[model samples]
Target chain A: MPERRSQRSIGGLTRRQVLGAALGAAALGAVGFRPRTAGAAQPPIRIGFCVPLTGPYGSEAQDQVRCAQLAVREFNASGGLNGRKAELLVRDSKLSPDEAATRTLELIENEHVDFVAGSLSASVQLAVNNITKQHRILYNSISQSDAINEPKDFSRYTFHEALNPTMTTDAVGRYAFPRFGKRVVFLLPDYAYGHEMTRGFKRVGKEFGIEVLSEIRHPLGTTDFSVFFPRIRALKPDVLVCCNFGRDQQITLKQATDFGLKRAMKIVYPILLYTARLAVGPRAYQGVVGGTSYYWGLEKTVPAAKQFNDRYRAAYGGRVPSDYGAFGYAGVRTILASVRQAGSVETDAVIRRMEALHYDFYKGPEYYRACDHQAVQSVLIVESKPAPADNQFDVFKILEVYGPNRVHLRSCRELGYS
Target chain B: MAALTPELLALQLLVGLALGAIYVLLAFGLSLIFGMLTVVNFAHGAFYMLGAYVAFAVAGLTGNFWLCLACAPVVLGLIGYGVERFLVSPLYGRGIDYPLLLTFGLSYVLVEAVRIIFGKQGYPFDSPAALAGSVEILGNYFPLYRLFVVAATGTIVLALWLFVEWTNFGLIIRAGARDPEILRVLGIDVGRVWRLVFALGTAIAAMAGVLAAPLQGVTPEMGDSMLIESFVVTVVGGMGSLGGAVLAGLLVGLVVSLTSVVAPELAKLSIYALMAAVLLIRPQGLFGRAGLLG
Candidate 1:
């Protein structure tokens, strides 16, 4: 009845009541509002890169650093993780385990970084892993050591961005042994990684019906390999596998060329570095079969990789990106993506999000396995070939790509990783 | 174990001789420096690295491997002259440890400096086109570059021996090694002689570096193993005898090379074993004078 009095009238409604309703609405609007000003309230996410910037691995470290910087730059340019800018703080590990530990701890305790990356040497990475694990900081290792993924060395916070020795050996050995010959000789560096690599090749090689005729574990950083060359020559194996790295790899390969080892049999490198190949020369490296995680020439086939290579060349004054650089770039990208997916930067949250994550950054479909934290991706079996006159970085032609399921070990459970 | 075939033995012997030649170059320089200065220049290895880097740079700029070889020793010799005059002159009266410590510190500085300049990656100066291939000898294939290395080293050692044995400068250097104080009293500038000998020793080490440039790619730390090997040569050969150093270099090289064929793990230890054997039998070494043993 009173409805007829005034359907549109604010009967008994006070001015203060209306004002209170408007005020509540305004407060709700303010609560939901986002300023879109580059995450003004949150601090920059910092990543500590503990690399050998001034030691035996300094140049390789520098290349990795450049790639990492490119990754950070791209990430920041595209409205960084959760709209927060990313920062990379580089510290030189100096190729010493103690120094690597010291620098890693400094980054964790002093600099308060969210994650850590970049160590070319396995020893340095292992040293850093201990520190990062204690602090529960995520460590993305660029070093290729199977020891890194061993149950005894495994940590939930650690992830290997690069291939392990087993992966490398599997990727290269399967292809090399069948084509070259079954009788292979090894020149391993006398260190943990070198030993693991030998074990890796032997473990995988046995499945391929390959026999290791002999192996020489030379001291790390040997200046002259002339002594071993004659031994290798005399052994007259069907394949000569070199497991040395850094300067040792360069010297051994050059001396191998000098000794005409290639003339006698196939000279295969399980883990070949671009810098080493360049030092050994294209003429020598040609016809050499090896496995690398990535090469810039693949940019032609992979659009994402091409994008990365284009930007990298533009930024680096036309210097092509090496596999080491790719590892560093992908490593940072993987960590940041985990943070994006988890919607938080908490170490446990991001690590949980990272496990079993399927992502691709330039390279083909890659995933960080939940078990061992090893990045499972396509291993590119490349044969070093002469580059076209127009291009210097086109040193390799990708012969085949092996999926993670094929090359990666299923022994994580046995190694104690849950 | 497989029996060594004749071909294998010949190849091993050739490699042993090549390895010995490099050791000789390194050890001879250490012997000269130790004899005249009474101060072991641990930095001698650093000088060798400088020579390699300089040669690499020269080869890169000029595209002439021979020019790199020719210029490296000269540049390093001049550097050694300056280093001896400025750094080593004041420490002559001090104990041998002072100069040794100075050179040790210098080694660190030089290695770090080279790392800063050239980086950790090695730069390859490929063996010249003429020497890139192998040569067949007695059913075994030997790298021509290696054969060249052996020949060059042999010639240099012979020339060095003749100079030390025949030249007046060599006589003064030999005399200075025995008694610098007596030489000073004999109206000879013992300090100048020491400086010249130090420079010569450094030049020889540099020459070894230049030769090694193609054999082993040039890296900042390339000389580290060489330094240790040279020390072993000095100890195994008499402390200050050039001919003893040569003999020990060849002996160590052979032992290391042959052992590596059958037992690689023992290759490094074999050199120390030889050193121990020498120490136990003849403290003065194969060609060392008994007086120098003191």
Candidate 2:
């Protein structure tokens, strides 16, 4: 063994004592330190997007996917949620409820997504809602299913980012009944969305003393509507309320023109999609009055909306985003805002912030109510005028913008929110 | 509810016939292929869908609807020939199930391939300007395009009937379908006849597709309902009977149209109901030969 070294001392403290003091201070520093402290690096917060990506609505789903991506890109470009970059996980729902639920769970359990958004059909949304409620993942639906926010379907973790059928009827019916006359015929798709629209229209019709001449429910993917036209024409209703969209709307409108139904009655789609108008051509939609939840023209009137539209069009091959796109962008943006406001990615904290938040998306100002998670936004009542000579997409001229006070359903407390 | 006036009834009848016209075209192809090849050709609807897409492309590029009508069938006929030679011909010696399974798989592949290429979004194809607008018929305003559909389909049907009943090659095809071995022993190349029959059947389906594209809008899934509906039409009319296909197509169309006025929900189910009723009454179908595929 080597000779033992003498103990060193400083300021009347032994060497061992000094070392013990230093090590104690390091222990204190390690125990007290936090990785999620302010201004520190953070892991990415992920959002799961479950939407129809292979069926008839696949093209519309692209709008949601692109806009959702755009929102994340913009948020990350602006330093993300408190300096933590926002990440998006997109899964194809295949327009199947089973697939939507499976993909949603995969996103939540496997991908560990903090939130989920996107759906066009009611069935898919309901399926996703069940899974999200069970898992307690925050789900913001862009679908306009009326039952989604009702007491029977209510969930604390779910919020609707788009307008419901009730609001659509109140807005479109209130506008059309007086101007277009009260005798109406409904050509609706035979499904929940169509049924909800029919119910809403009937309610508003009853309120306005409008007579429903007839209600014809056609199969969802009907390629022909001539069989129903003879009945519609025989009744000679003042207005034909078309509660259909996508290819159905396009096909029916084209055939309506063929059958000369336009000559005797005014044609209207209670809710018109931008793709439908474009697909059918402006000539088919000219002089038609309808309701749209969002339009790119609103960007010209609203500064914040204009900014978002400008950036979106620039990134998406100069293609203007539809209301569906606006809803998707709004969903992601609102979720991110909630995350930032709460200063944490915890579901409850974000829910609290989202409930109280008011923000402008690619439309006017909007907010989510605390009780039902219904976003209070303006409904666009529009007329499809001949597109101006300078612009190709300027098919609609906004007639009026109905605020949430004018169009929204009763408060969540009254609606029996869970 | 108002009374059903004579004009209304007449108009509804005409509309039913117009719709039936398309069914006739679709069912005719299905009947011919089954009659001649004994192959179900489940991909018949997929070929129809491809024809519509071809028409859409040709019309878009050429800005001529007539060109699409002319070219789509020809293009589909060539594709049919290739399909029969490479994919369907080898399974000829095997049981009917083999070709049926092959066609079913081919249908899935075609539909998915279409989805990959053109996407699920529907492409807009406008009716020709000449066919646009309505014309007064029997004191009722009817779509001129619908009248064209009826006329065109009628002409095609007549031509098909003539070919089957009048032509020497048609006799060979009919004989081959009835007894391929007899035709083979008679020194008539039944294989060549089979290929021709398959091409003709696909061509007819394609023709229907081109005609219906503007009305229905081209979609990858458009072929799905068409296939099922055609099957219903085939079974009711009697599989392998071209004339029976026409009769059954019209009957089904009339049933659906008339039922819609009374109860719209029964329109689709009515077809199945009719099929079941007919099958229960005559298992071989109204026109299908006895002891044949039911």
Candidate 3:
């Protein structure tokens, strides 16, 4: 028979007694432990990125994520926020406002992110802003929308990194009206973005003695533009201002080219995306002129642009960053810089820091206007190259550059900020 | 609004015909599959999208649009035959819902697989150089490529009519559709006829996709909206009726074009309104026989 073994004792105490003593010491140590201070072993700061990772804008959204990733990498390489590295938590907005809200709530409530940024659709960004506003989280909107800058959608935490439709229209109208006649017809997608673009064009048109021939509003994502071609041709306008985005823009441009509408009127898209141009190919987009937030061609003049393009190309398989993608880079870069400048991720501190920041990150001089938190930045008027160039990224030729100024922006009083 | 002149009206009618041609190509395929197999193919659109991608690949390799056009239908037809034989044929004895559900799942799988193989970004497919420019018609400029589409659709319609109405194989197809058990008793392989019908349907859809590639760039989701619209076309034309599909396609296109002239926002909604109207008046559809579904 095996002998019965008693519990081993240590230091003249029974095993249970020693274990209880050790547990008590551990409890005491746990109670005494405190989190490390800033600059110590702190957790990485999280920025919840909400964008349309699916739907028609999937490619553009992927590019945005790539640009944001580059921004995060640069931030961490430069010792992000006092040695606390920055991290991105990405969630698909799905290009739907309701989906964006749900995903954003998950990001804040479950993931516990410090800030939120992203959105390609104007309406979708507004949805995200509403959620971020209620939660008191700083949100840098990277999509173009004039409605978001109005008092109805404005908040202390809201900062628009992209140029609003008003700014884009002003730049395009001022440049194109003098070059391509003042008689214009507007083919706009029926949405907040389209309506805002029309408002801006009409406002700018008044200054150029523009005769508004007709304004054709089609449903968003209209694949067949054949029905509207007859009407547009009947109007016979000198300039056709197409205010559509993503797939809508691509289809409209291609169909319009097929119908030979480009032969009659000079087509001017308010915001011509680099991705859209690539999707439509040289033949469809050839000779089309529009305003862009950023173009790789700007690297020829701006040192910062050159640096950004070089870094982006080196990291992303030699493909230049797109215009919408550049907004992602600028938004994340500026927000992270604000966090560093404030020395904290506190909402109020970051807001204050962002408000005072005069940044020349990827593009030329840019600053957030105090009234509406809209970024005042340069708008590049670019014309699509008529033929395929040696460098594929050389899709556009910079016709003119409108420098950063409030001249194109609505006044503080107009924004109901007085 | 621009004044609607006689010339403008004529031009709009031509445009409607061109638009209807695409809808007919898509709807006929759906109608054929439903008529022969009684399977509501939710993957019809996916097949269409696959056709466009295949065409894009073929064109890239050979740099010939005509060759790609010929290759897309053959490739899609083979794929359809395999799918029908392996995936769909086994579920014939089961309720129709089984095949319907299976096809619905298959659609998503195909779209995702395409996305994986070809990046999410769309690729441009320019029209052939011969059809690149617009021709002046009725005192207005109209796309020559669109005219070609109309002519091609008319030819397909006539060919399909002759094949279905006059050919011995077509008589067997009709006989099998009416009573497959009777046809089986006569030593005919009804299953083979159904598989061929399914393959033919998918091939037609793929052909439509090849034609549409230039009008809209090739993308994974290109067939999604087209599929939904074509379903409405199939139902309004009388499900399983080729003649009905052609008529309904044109009618829907006309309604959309006319509504767009008055209220552009209602263009898309107009087609659904037409479907609802048709369903309310004649539930079996314009050309459908009553008690067919019952």
- For each candidate, C-alpha RMSD in Å? 13.4, 12.7, 10.7
Better of 2 and 3 by lDDT: 3
| Candidate 1 colliding pairs | none
| lDDT for B185 (candidate 1) | 93
lDDT of each: 0.79, 0.81, 0.85
lDDT by residue (tens digit), candidate 1, A57-108: 5556667876787787777778887678776666667678998898788778
Better lDDT candidate (1, 2): 2
Question: CA shift at A252, candidate 3, in angstroms?
Answer: 1.6
Candidate 1 runs further than 4 Å off: A1-43, A54-56, A81-83, B289-294
Candidate 3 structure quality by residue, lDDT tens digits, A315-402: 7557788999899999999999999999999999999999999998888999999988999999999988754456777788999899
Ranking by lDDT: 3, 2, 1
Worst ten in a row by lDDT for model 2 chain B: B115-124
Model 3, native contacts kept: 0.67
lDDT of 1 by residue, B181-265 (tens): 8899999988888888888888899999988888877877778878998899988888788888898888888898899888887
> Residue B139 deviation, candidate 2, in Å?
4.7
How do all models score by TM-score? 0.90, 0.92, 0.92
Docking category of candidate 1: acceptable
Candidate 2, residues A39-82, lDDT tens digits: the string is 54775787888777665665567677667877877877787766
Off by over 4 Å in 2: A1-43
